[model samples]
Target: MVAGDGQGKNIHDLPDEIILDVFSFFSFNELIDILQNVCVRWKRLAHDPVLWCDKEYIVRGRAQNGRSCCGVTCSECAHCRCEKTDREVLRTAGMMPQLWTLTMMRGTRARILRKICRNCPNLTTLQLHGCQKMNYSLLKYIFEKCPKIEKLIIANNLLADRQYTELVSCLEHLQSLEVFENRRGAGPVLLRFLADTCSKLREINLSCDYHPLEDVEYFVKAKRDTLTSATVRWTMAGKRCVVPVLKEAASSLKKLQLRLFDVALEEEAATFADLGELHNLRELHCNQLCPHRPRLISLAFQPGCLPLLQKLDLPHATDLPDDAVVTISRGCPSLRHLSLTFATSLTDGALAEIHRLKHLQILDLSGCSGLGGSAVAHVAQLPALRTLLLQYIDDLTDLQPSLRHVLDLKQLRCLDILYSGHIRAVPFEEFSVRLVNFRELHVTYEEEDEVFYKNVLLRCRVKCLGSG
Candidate 1:
C-alpha cells in the first residue's frame, strides 16, 4: 500500500527526552545490549547526558537465609555482570557532560571518578557505601566540579588527609553530609571549616557516638540559633565523656542523640530542663547504659519540653515506671513514631495508654518480654500504625489469637516478629488473604518449619529466620 512506513524508523525517530525516558526503564545489561547494536541514530540518542545521568545500575544477587557455601561473592556472580555494568558506566561518563546522581559501591578506581566528574559537571547526590581504592584526588575532583551538591554520603573510611581537607574546604555548600569513619585526627580542621564556611549545612553525623558540644562550636558561632539537626557520639559503651559538651550543643539542637552516653542517667536529668528550650525539636534518641526508669519518665513528662517531639527512641530503658507510658501518650499529642526496645519494665498498662497517640505510625517493642497478646491487642486499635515490630516476647505463642484483632490496622504494611523464641509456624494463609494489602510480613520459625511458611503462605513475602 503506502510502503508500510518501514518499522517506524526504529528508536531513532523519537525525541531525545522520550528516548531517554524509555531507556530509564531498561536494566543496565539491557542498555549495554542496545548499545552494542550498530545503529547510527540509536547510538547518537544513547549518548544523551540525561539517559546516562538518570540511570542507576545496581548489581544484586540472591541472598540466602543462613550461611551457605556459595555466599554473596562477586566471584559467583552471573556471566559478564560486573563487566557489562562497568562498560556502560565508562561509556556514559566518557560521552555525557550533564550526568548526575552517581552511586557505585563496588570496585571504583580514581581514574573512573576523574572521568565521571570531567564529563558530568552537574553530578549530585553521591553515595559511596563501601567503595575501596578511592583516594584524595578522586574526591577533590568530584567536589571541585559539583560545588552545589545537596547530599554527600561517604559511608566507608577510605580517605587520605588531602581528600578530607579538600572535601570540607570546597564542599561548603553541602546541605546533608554523613561520614561513618572515626576521623578524630581531621576533626578539628574539618569542624572549624564547617563552622566558619558551612553555615547553610543542616544535618551532620560524624561519629556513631555523640560528639561533644565544643566540637560543634561553629554551629553556635556561625549560625547561632538557626541550627536544626545534629548527632554526636558523646560516649562509647565502656568509655564515658563529660556532659558539658553535649549540654551546650543541645541548647539550639532540634534533633539530638546520646547513642553511647550511658553513665549520665542521673546526673544529666536536669538537662531535661535544657530540652524544654528546644521548641522546634522533633526527634530524640537517648540510650543510657544504666537505665533509670524514673529519670526517663521525668524527662518524658517534662513540662512543655516534648510538645513538638514526633519521634522518641528509648531502647534498653528499664527506668520507665508504670504511669510513664500513659503520661507520654497524654503529653505529646503529635508523637507519631515510638520505639521501646529492651525495656523490661514495660507492661500491658503502658501499652494501654499507647492507643491515645492518634498519629502513631511505627511501634517497636523488640525486647519487652512481659508483653502478651493483650498488649498487641491494644496496639492493634491504633488507626494510623503502619509498621509493628515485636521481638523476644516469649509470652506471644499464638499468632491467630493476636493477628485476628490486629488485622483491623488497615494501613499496616509491615509486621516483623524476629527471634521471638516461642513463635511457632502457623498457617498464615487466612491472614494473608484477609490482609491482601500487606507488603511485608516477617515471622520467625524453627529451621525445619521455614520451608512451610516460605511456600505455603500466599500473597505473603515471608522471611523465616532462626528463632532459638
Candidate 2:
C-alpha cells in the first residue's frame, strides 16, 4: 500500500523531521537502550539534540556490576551507572544544549548529576525520582548550578532535614515545585521559603503530611490566576477552608487533586462545597473521600458546567447515585477519561448518560455493584473507547451478552473484569478466535483452563491476566 505516485512508495523513507518527532516520544532509556540499536539511521535519529530538549525526557540510571565499561559499544556500555560510564553518558547528553525538562531515576548516582549540572545552563525543569540517600548538599549543588531551574519534582527519595542556602536563593525564579516527601524533605523550611518568595509559582504539589493548611491557602491566594495546578494533602476541615480561596483563580486552575487526610470524612459532610465554580478545569481527582450518602445527591455539577474538563476521578464516592453521574455527563461533556471506581449506587441509566461523553476513551467503574451486563452494551456504543475496567462487579452476570456487545467497540484494547465471579471457562473457549484488537483481558479462571489459556490466549493476540 503505497501512494499513487511511484516516487513516494516506501513508508521506510519517511522524512527526517517526521522521524525525529517520533523518536522524541521515546523515553531517554528507550532512546539509548532500544532506538540506538535499531539501525544506523534510527541510531542517528535517536541522537538528535532537538528531540531530547524541552521535554520530560527521563534519564534512568541503571545498576552496573560496580565496574567500568571496557570501552566496547555493546550492552551495559555506558547505559549502566559506573563511574566512568556515568561521565560518558553525561558528556553525550551535554550535546543537547538548552535542555529544559529532565527526570533522573532512583539509584542513579548523585555524583553523575553533580558532573552535569553545570552544563545545564538553560535547564528549567528537573525531577529526581527515588535517587537513594539524597541529602541537602546534593540538592543545593543542583540549585546553585542550574540557576534557571523553574520546576523541581523530587519523589520517592530520602531527604532528611538539613539547611541549604542555595534552595532559598534560587527559589526566586521558581514557577513549579513538587516534593513527595519520604523522610523530612518538604518540612517547614521549604514551605516558609515558598510562602515568602516564588511569586511567579504556578504549580505546587507537596503531597506530604508536613504541608500545613495555611501554606495551601497562601499559595492559592498569592499566585491566584498564575496557579494552574495544585496537588496537596488536606484534612476535611482544611478542604472546606480552601474552597473559598479556590474560587479566586477558578478560571485559571486546570488540574486539582485533593487527597483527604486518612480519617473518617463523615464528620465534614454537612458542610462541603461541590466545586461547580471550576468551569475551566481540565482534570479533578478526589482521593479517599467518602462523604455522606445524602450529600451525594446535592453534588453541584450543573449541565454544561465543566465544558473544558477532560478527566474526573472520584474513586471513593461510595454511594454516588445515577442523577449525580448524569449531571457529570451533562456538565463534563468533554471528558475523555472518567473514573467512579466505587460508586455502588449507579445503575444502567448512568451508563446511558455516560455514552453522551462522545470523546471518552478510558472508563473505570470497577466496583459499581448496580451495573449489569446490559451496561456493557451501553458503553460499547462509545466510538473512541480504548480501555474499560469493570472489576469486582458480580452483578455483571450476563457474560455471553457482554462479550458480544463489546465487539462493537472497534478501538477497545483492554477489558478488565478481574473479580466477576459469574465468568466461567466454557464461554471463553471460543473467545480466543472471536476477539478483535483485544490486547489485554483480565478474568478470573480455574486451574483447568490455565494450560489451555497459556497456549490459546496467545493466538487471541492478548495478554491474559488472572489465569493462575
* Model 2 TM: 0.70
lDDT of 1: 0.61
Per-residue lDDT tens digits for candidate 2, residues 1-468, read 253457755645789998787776665556756777768887777767686553343454455333212443223333322223454556556544445665565445777677567666667887776545567888777778888888777652332233442354456677777777555544443454565566777887756655455656666777777889888654423343455457777868999887763433553432234366677789988776555453443354677556888998988677676777878777777889999898877778877777778999999989987775567778888889989897887745643466467767777777777876656522455445555566777777676767766665564544445644
> Residue 215 error for model 1, in Å?
4.3
Query: What lDDT does the true structure give each of the candidates?
Result: 0.61, 0.65
User: Candidate 1: where is the Cα deviation over 4 Å?
Assistant: 1-109, 127-139, 153-167, 183-189, 208-212, 235-254, 263-266, 287-294, 301-303, 316-324, 392-395, 398-404, 422-436, 446-468
Query: In candidate 2, which residue pairs get closer than 3 Å at backbone N, Cα or C atoms, i.e. clash?
Result: 106-130
For residue 79, give model 1's deviation from the true position in Å: 21
